[model samples]
Target: MTELNISTTAGVFDATAAGPAEGRPVLLLHGFPQTRLAWDRQITALAAHGYRVVAPDQRGYSPGARPERPDDYRISLLVDDVLAITEELGWTTFDLVGHDWGGAVAWWTADAHPGRIRTLTVVSTPHPGALADALRTDEDQRARSHYMLDWRETPKTENDMLADGADSLRALYAGKVPQASADAYIRQLSQPGALTAALNWYRSGRPRHAIGTIDVPTLYIWSTDDAAFGPAAAQGTEQWVNAPYRFEALRGISHWIPEEAPETLNRLLIEHLQTHEEH
Candidate 1:
């Protein structure tokens, strides 16, 4: 894979890219606390299959794109960045995939611009509306998401994550992610203002980013053991999709689905992408 700096209307974003330039375009967005490295396995696998893949260090995660004010990290702006990045890549329409926080952005983008998204694949995170529904109706889900409260306390979280050599931050991976990849994530987030900027994703704007049902052919992958989400959230996700939709539950997997279950996730992703072509 080759590293690249992609210029968008917002700013230059550091990205990891691969595959033939003429191949079908695929844009992958990484979640918080991680960089474009999160998609390493998928990038190589997809490039071999003749699909051009690019995963950007979205928003606050990229040094060149990080903005100081929390308001700059709004979901509308994040979605704008995605649209702008695709425009910069010369893709009129493309397959989109996202994980964790990235998945939230993906859901909103596909909903807001279904005509431009040939397909949607999201891992580990449910649609924001579904999550909101669960948080209100499902006590278990609300309890699970309580850590988001701590994340909003940026000063405390930064200190807790940085103190003791960022033991708390490293523990987020729970040893599920590869050591090298996890180390790279820790190093990037440990940089000055990086952790706060990353946390801004949680603190940005209001409760939900997505407003309507999505019509794009969609795939939602949820792991049974995901601590931050529950069955209630996953069950409601399909209802938010107005078009062809598939929901897969990995019985023993965790929230870090891409890292912990790359092979499974990749197989599902490739099949979904193949099932839906850019038009």
Candidate 2:
């Protein structure tokens, strides 16, 4: 893999990329507390399959892109960052894959720029409207998402997560990700202002624009053991997607699908990408 510094409106983003220059372009976005490394396995798999893969450490996670204001991490800006990176890469259209918080941003990007995104794949995060409704009316979803409250608490959340050498943050993987992999993620987040910038994604409240229907071909992957995103929201995700959509549930898998279930995710991604091959 080649390390790259991608310039965006917010700042230069740190990214890792692979595959041939002439291959089909694919953009992978990582979620909270993790860097572009989260897509390492898929990057290798997809690149080998002849797809140009690029994974960017979004917004606050990249040292150069870290903005101090909580509001700067809003979803709209986050979406803009992805578009900017792709535009800089000279990809007029590309396949997009995102996990956790990244999935949320991907949803918004696909909705806002339908013609620019060829195919959309989201892992472990439901559509914004599905999630918003569940968070408001579903007790189970609200209970599972209670951690968002703590994450929005600024210094307190950072202190608690950083305490005992970020043991709390490491626990998030729940034994699904290998120790070395988890360690890499923790180290990146341990950097000064890194953790807070990641949490800012949560503090930036959901905007009404995020509730629209996605018109591009889409795929939603959810694991049964995900602690934060519940099935109720996953089931309702289709309601917000007006385009062709497929939902896959990984039974007995944890939230860290990219690491723990890379093979399955890769296969699904290849199938999705092939089905909607850029013609």
Candidate 3:
């Protein structure tokens, strides 16, 4: 993969591109505490299959892409960053695949500008409306999401996450991310202001018009053992996509779907991309 410093309306963004540059472009957005390298496995395979994969480090994670204010990291702004990057790449329409927080951004993008997205595949995140509803009415979801409040609403949350040499982060990736990948993330967040900027995603309230129906060929993939989301939220995602939708549930997989089950995730994504090939 080659690194790219892309200029967008928000600011300069750090991105990684792989596969044949001449092939159909597929924008891959990664979630929190992760860099574009998270898609390493999928990148090579997709590229071999005749697709160009572009993965951005995203708002807070990319040193050059970090915004100054917490409000700047809001979901709307994050969505705009994706749009700006795609436009900067001269892509009028392309396939989009996002994981975790990246999935959240992709959901918003597909809903707000359906024509710009030929197909969408989201992993390990529910549609915004489904997440919101679950957060409001489901006690289990609320309980599980306590970390969001701690990171977003509480004052010392950022400090706490970095305390004791980022022990919390270490624990979160203990069994998931490879040691090399985990080390890279730890080093990146160790930089001044990076972790705080990342945490800001939770600090802001949901984007004003976050909840909307996505009108494009869509695929939602969920792992049964993901700690952050439950069956209710995952199943409810159907109501928000007004187009052809496919939902796949993987048993025994964790939230780190791409890393934990790369082959499986790749197969699902390839199938979705091929089935919804642009005209």
Residue 96 local lDDT, model 1? 95
Better of 1 and 3 by TM-score: 1
Predicted model with the maximum lDDT:
2
Lowest summed lDDT window (length 10), candidate 1: 202-211
3-38: candidate 1 lDDT, tens digit per residue: 889887688899989999999999999997788898
Candidate 1 residue pairs in backbone clash: none
Q: Compute the lDDT of residue 75 as modeled in candidate 2.
A: 79
Error of 1 at 3 (Å): 1.2
Q: lDDT per model, in order?
A: 0.90, 0.91, 0.87
Arrange candidates by lDDT, highest first: which order?
Answer: 2, 1, 3
TM-score, candidate number 3? 0.96
Alpha-carbon TM-score of each model against the true structure:
0.97, 0.97, 0.96
Among all windows of 10 consecutive residues in model 2, the one with the lowest summed lDDT is 203-212
Q: Count the backbone clashes (under 3 Å) in each candidate.
A: 0, 0, 0
Pairwise lDDT winner, candidates 1 and 2: 2
Candidate 2 vs 3: which has more TM-score = 2
